[model samples]
Target: MSDSEPRMIEILRILSAHDKPIGSKLIAVELREKGFNLGERAVRYHMQVLDEKGYTERKGYSGRVITELGRDKLEKGLVYDQVDFVYSKFEEMIYLTDFNYMTQKGNVVVNTSTIYDESSINILKKIIESGLSVSPYINLNEDKSEGKIEVTTLCGTTIDGILLNEGISSQPQYGGLLKIEDYKPIRFEELISYKKTSLTPLDAFSSPNRTSVLDVIETGDGIIPANFRLIPGVGRKRTLDIINKLDHIGIGGVIGISDEGRDILGIPVPEGMVGIAIVGGITPFRAVQENGEDIDIKIAEEIRNFNTLSPITTKITYHLKPVEHDIQPKISFLLSKSWNLIQQVNFDIEKRKGDIVANVSYLKRDDLDETLNIMESLYNDNPKYINPYYKVLDHPSDDDKVGIATICSLSIDGILINNGVICNPKYGGLLELTEPPLFIELISYNGSTVDPHKIFIAKDMTRITREAGSKKILASFKEIPYISRDYAVDLLDTLDKIGLSIYKISKPRELTYNAKADNYNFGIVAGSGLNSIAAVREKGIDIHVKAIEKLMPFEKMDRL
Candidate 1:
């Protein structure tokens, strides 16, 4: 599929998606609304070709409807996706992205990457403004309560929503906006921009991963503090560029950008921390000079000179990814590949004065290759080990294939444990009643999304919990599921390298779980879900019909 696939696929999609047939004029209108310039005649011609090709059908008076064949073509040709990219320097980027992190108490800390090129801001601004005007879905926050209905552009939005358009466009670099030789870089702000996703040079961190940058304040004369130099990504050039831009605008805010960037200025934090960041890619301390104020730079240079003389310690935590096929060979190859890739690109995979050692354990590897491949194809991005979704899967069931397929279906990294069958309320004598089997395969590596690798039992239940996992994990007063282990064994093996620790303690006082309620379902509790409905049905409540009867009142009401 080339650049034209989007329009052609969209035509098939809109036609097949509609309940009734749509005319060529209507299809052209839909395409134009999504920023395509195709006219009615061109659309009609495409429709005729599609009919000739058995991809669409045309009734005498009615217009076009997509055939099963056409739908298949559309599905294969165009894929829908949402993804992120990290920009390093001009035309220098690799496959990487960040996830929305949260604090232990559960607040959203945005995951963002830098655009390196200052000139890209001009491109970003243009895209944002234009997309804001054209994209009817992304920037709308309708004040439905207003007396006078005046449609206008939206200014603010909550953080969870994506700012990209729902429609397909004619743009070649539709995923993001970028300019490169023999390639076009996607500027995401224009392609699928979000209101909460937009930021300027003034945006900076307040706490490591606590506050939102959009909440930052402005100084006088529409200028805001942009002291962005402090961040590792900003470096010196971005700081200078930001300062020079601010100087031209003249500030009413901080006389210049402050260390807070736009995070804080004259503004006071209302208080309380909200989000958390993973801080992966752990490494050992090393000496390096960084630019700063003249005196600070001198001190940093001197410190580096002194630091290099000090003996260094090396640390390596191999993720030791497992394979469905060739586990040993893959592990060997991964280690060898790591070493080879290091020396091959002169990446300096090692430092001085440290011997690399291995810590082998009961291993379970999470290879998110299939999901990564699908996403890469959809976004037309490069394929690597980059994953945005991770999991903590277990093989509690005899169905190891289900267990394997469950984790293989995520967008990130994960753990795989063969920890027997999961427990439900109804039946459980060994695995659940006595103590849940939490035998973990303590493999090492880092990535996103900690989906459980084991079964939640039923496929429906796993599906539901997986949806809930995406809801929120860490938060204030957070209580994760109970673990059966005595030590912080899994946490120490996995997250310890990154300096994160889990406080897994035992019950100070324990009560023997003697089978006290034999009739928990009937005499005492009505049970958990549909069974409860069945119980109520036994009580002559007719809950099955009652539930639908309750909705009749709402369905009866018409226009307000």
Candidate 2:
């Protein structure tokens, strides 16, 4: 109805006729050929206008596509004035031999790219559907050795040209006739060679069904008519089985199919056939050895042997240390004497492969009598020592009360207080010792004991000095001495000043009691008057069940 309406309709028609979205440049070319004056910019503007009105939509930056509204309008029919103008323009370009001819069918100008033939039109439609834009004519000039046929698209851009030939051996030259942009060139000689080796299929078959046939073609190695037989009733199951077997044998592909012996099975034309294909070449399997040499046979044999044997379950060994010190002198002595004592006490301990020897020595002197006599007197006279040492040792001390001094030693299983008094009242009295002592005993478990001869002693005087602060008499000798009362007193003084509490003492009776007991599980028996001298003697040490009752109140007496 408006002056621009007819032009807009014409633009819509051009776009609707294209198989793909048409670019503004192509639309401009179409308009130019129709004798209409329009530039690329003007065409682009009209396209945008159409798009805004919902008649067209932008496909990309360079192109536009017809929308549903444009299709509906085309079906309804064009106005008379627009139709006449389109037809007059089409008439100027129409040719008799050209397939794309313009004709008037009522008020519509019917311009078709196909000749007025059903087969030709159908072929054209198929080509378009296949995503190809074909030219209006085909050049068939046999005289021109390298005939040139140029084709321009509606967008005025030349895509690509093809070279036509009669036979497979023909070499394509520049610009013959066909326009094939997607296909790659293949020589007739190659195809013939493939055919000779049964590589090429005689007829096209679906990829899935033609697997065996294709395989035969590949492995034939340029040889022709290879022979092979397929088993009968070879449906999917048999086919798959055969394929797997063939693969294992280094054979591949299906060259030919036949039913040479299916009659014996009473079946006609077996479900699948045995076929002749080529045997594929194989590379021998190999492994690199530690010496970097390729080992094929050895590796294969090893793999075969490994596969034959049952898989072994790997096992790992773990050693758990004693969680709590039982305080039995023999067990504690063994454990403290050597680090390996804990390992030896395990019931499940394995015999070690090598010999384990322990070296031990004792530093003794008569001058230590003074320090030892004082410690012995404290144990005998102190009321705390009247009962048992452990009871006095286990009791808590007053906040401001500094504990007594003592001579102590490291046993295999635990610490040993030689001459000391329990000072903490809760355990009866805290222990005081003149110096750490040296003792020998076999490592033991709940009842079993090891050899005492295997015991080792290593004195850590620095650790003792650090533990016993500078308050006691022995703290003056910070460095350890191999002899004399100065060393003994210094060690005790260092221990007392360092705030180290007395843990346990060395008593031969504790070891003897554990050795004689049916079950070596003995609890500590100590009282407030904890005398270390009496505690060490076999008969003097009394079993104070009351201390056990007091220390382990929660523990069931029967359980103990």
Candidate 3:
């Protein structure tokens, strides 16, 4: 394969990343950003070659766009050139990843897979809980037309991205199956060097019959997919520190790491380099395949926000078994009884404590039961939107005279995420009621340990329920990527149909009411799910509210 082929592939990639045509001059600039030394003249030369091959087509003087053939060629380049292209692409994705571990924000790379049969979800859940997968977090969306469920998992490349952000350079070495004994990784049983394959090595090595991940989980002895990497010896301590930090934040994939000059598992390392092995995110898919279920997976598909994923358990919350009958009939009475409770305006602060206490007790006993029953009904209806934490709470906390759990506005982020939209929730604040609602107070979601909504409420920053017809209320603003505007619109509409609280969704590069969005992103304003809870707190009622509490299935939520 000629060296120029890889450069052409890069051009195609740049074109694919954008929906508009691009000229050679602009392409050269983008290439320079990627550290390529290509100049405008050099890019034009390549463009001519691509044009002759019909891989690219010139559009109305706007320059050239990659054609369908170009997309195919980019995806499957010259076989001999693939190894270099694959590894180079890995580095490029790392550079593209903007996820900041410190702020707990930005996008991390992920692997997206699809399973057609609904029955395999339970098996996948077992694999995830058994710790045979990369991260406990996952993203799932159903494709009704294709009758498939798409699953997204954290790619091992995310570690490299995080490491790069920390000023540490990591070199991807290979991907293979690592044997395990007594729950400890023993050695690599099979290996495919990243520098020698056009395909993602982990994806290449994964096979239903070839892997024994289920056995590993059950017997503590078997094989699972793993990736190998090398980092400068001096960075071992720092690397471990990063891994520790990731673990604390619920992001796990690094299975094992070796000391300087030592081998990882049974693989030898360079003299001054340490070897690191990462558990492959494809393991869950492999487990499903091993169970004779049909599945499709794309390894290291793209970069996405670290916060976008939910625990794998959330995906299986409602679909684990078949329903014997409709639950709507069973829950209809409860829904009727609690309809007013769900739709009640913020409580009156002037009410006596005894009266408030009685109301709280009634809401707790009746509303709570109705909420759980609604979630169950939802699980049977549409499990994807249910919150995962509701299963764990059986009763209100003793300290909290009133306990209320509302679906946070951040749940919109989750919805957008599942639909391939990377939504960054920028602020949780008081949105003043006016001709155009304006945010008077704002707190960033990044770098905050506590939910900003909770902090605002605790600080008494809201006047949502101070009056019977208060104009001001709590709300949140999120940034949606410009390219995914259409997807976000449709998904937001779906949320509205389901009765989720949404205030405004801005046009591309526009403000939503008064919430601002950058040129590259659109803004979304959603009423805080805790608006009711906040009103209760305004009354001096001892109510505890949790925002973005947990990933609960949509089915579990009953709209107030």
Candidate 4:
């Protein structure tokens, strides 16, 4: 690549980041932020050259746009390689959770050029057939940025590494797998109306196409408004027909919903039948063969009773999966384009016995560099441990990157991408409202386990709950991920609305991520656990803080 190629790639990156067109002046501003010293005039010259080469299209007063060719270059890792990239903006974390969890248990390491390569389908089947667990490795290069001289395999690796090693590689990316007939796409508007009809997230999700181990029984009549086809479609008859056909194949279920949810969607209403809008979410049962082999899907449920929804953002889940492919390129592209943004984020790393728990006060999709540093530090510091600790990265972001990095990092177990404060970038981002965090964990690589008690999350949870009593404490305010601060004013106001005592919890080490749902579940234990008062009475405040600290360093414990 030519020397100017890097600068051109940067321009293309900026253009692709935002949905709207951009101008040379704006591009110049971004370049300056990225440590470039040039003025807008220099950017204009570059833009002109890029325009001639069909890399960008000038949109009159709006600005320039990256063309398909430019996007191809960026996606293909020409001048702007996805490997060793940084990011500030990102898509939802749930996708990251899916990518990481899906690949972590495999024995083969399949490397796909892009997320769309059809080879993943074959690779997955091969894993099943060979009965070998596999891990998909992205980006072949190592991150020597942390001062390591050897070119080790960080997380992202080139396809050549796959071909050279025992790993597998497909031909250069042609396109995504042809539309798999497994799922039938329903109208978006219909689904939206269905959600409004249910009024509950649990009831709403039950209507989607999914698979699980056990079928949920409904509390009332199982019919949901979405279960029936609507508008330009047939109604109950179609849904019944589909359900019957699916059941005939062994997928047994009446109306699609949990027994309790049945009443929520259909039974509780006094009005006439709301009818089914769609008939789906049934997983055809696989009868065990003579060898007793069968695909047994395990169903999971969200624990909300003990979980507290707080601050304005309330919840950020990287736990959800099966995101649409059309929106995923940005999930990967987000970090590569917003490298500077990643540097602006903050996080802390701690040891949980044999695992590393990283609690990020705030994060975004592009800040991957910092996450890698933490993971490598954990791995290097404890060489005695076979694989070190089961690595965990937890962060909140609008578009997420830290967890994505940790998820893709070497020797990691699983991760939950949390969304922090999210504000429209077009609106100048949190303005002057962002608050100085209660604390900032300096990113440190190469450190021993922070706390010996930080072992299996269950043991820690048991200790916390036993010590905790009836007083529930919620300490937080609404704030954007890295831009603005969420004020304690909201927290105080909330406490006033509901009578409650204040108990401060101290945060000393890295907030640990113990459960697959641990990242979010810890918030529940801290915010709404009935054991809070019992723990206070049993252990007093100092010990209480230490007890909780074993699981996580509670920043607002002092406030409580």
Clashes of each: 38, 64, 10, 65
For each candidate in turn, the TM-score is 0.23, 0.19, 0.52, 0.21
User: What is the alpha-carbon lDDT for the whole of candidate 4?
Assistant: 0.27
User: Who wins the TM-score comparison?
Assistant: 3
Give the per-residue lDDT of model 2 (tens digit) for 1-560: 34565577778878877878889899999888756689999998888888888889887775888999888655332323322332233223222112111120111111111122223333322222221221222211122333321111110000000000111111111100111111311111100111111011111111111112112122311111111122333333444444344333222222222233222111123334432221110001000111122221110000011111121111211111111211212112122233342223221112212111211111122222332343355445433222111211222333322222121211111111122211111101111232331111111211111111111101111111123442111110011112232333443344323222223321222322111111222212121211222222212222221110111111111100
Q: Which consecutive 10 residues in model 4 have the weakest lDDT in total?
A: 425-434
Model 1 agreement with the true structure over 1-560: per-residue lDDT tens digits? 23554577668867975888889888999888656799998988778777888989987788877888887665433211001111111011111111111211211112122222333333323322221111111111223454221111111110111101111111111011111111111111111111111111111111011111111111111111111011222332443353344223210111112232222212211223111111110000000000110110000000011111111111211111111111111112122222322222211112211111111111123322342233234223211111112122233442322111100110000110112211111111111111321111111111101111111111112111122222111100011123423222343233222212121222322111211112111100011111112112223331111110000111121110
Model 2 segments more than 4 A misplaced: 82-93, 96-560
Cα-based RMSD of the predictions, in order? 27.0, 42.2, 23.1, 22.8
Q: In order, what lDDT does every prediction score? A: 0.23, 0.26, 0.66, 0.27
How close to the true structure is residue 290 of candidate 1, measured as C-alpha lDDT?
9
Clashes of 2: 64
Where is the poorest 10-residue window by lDDT in model 1?
Answer: 281-290
Instruction: Say which candidate scores most in lDDT.
Output: 3
lDDT of 4 by residue, 1-560 (tens): 34566678778888988788899889999888766766989999999999898888989899989999878656432311221132111111111212212122212111111112233333323222211111111122223454221110111111112222222211111001011112221122112111101011112232222212111111211211122211112223433453454333222112221121122222121132222222221111111111123222211111111011111111222111121322211112111222223223232212111222222222343534443354345335422211221222344434443332111111011111112323211000000101211111110111111111111121122222232332111121111222122332233233322222112211222121110111112110012121232222233221111111112222222111
TM-score ranking, high to low: 3, 1, 4, 2
Alpha carbon deviation, residue 283, candidate 2 (Å)? 71
Name the runs in model 1 displaced over 4 angstroms.
Answer: 1-3, 79-560
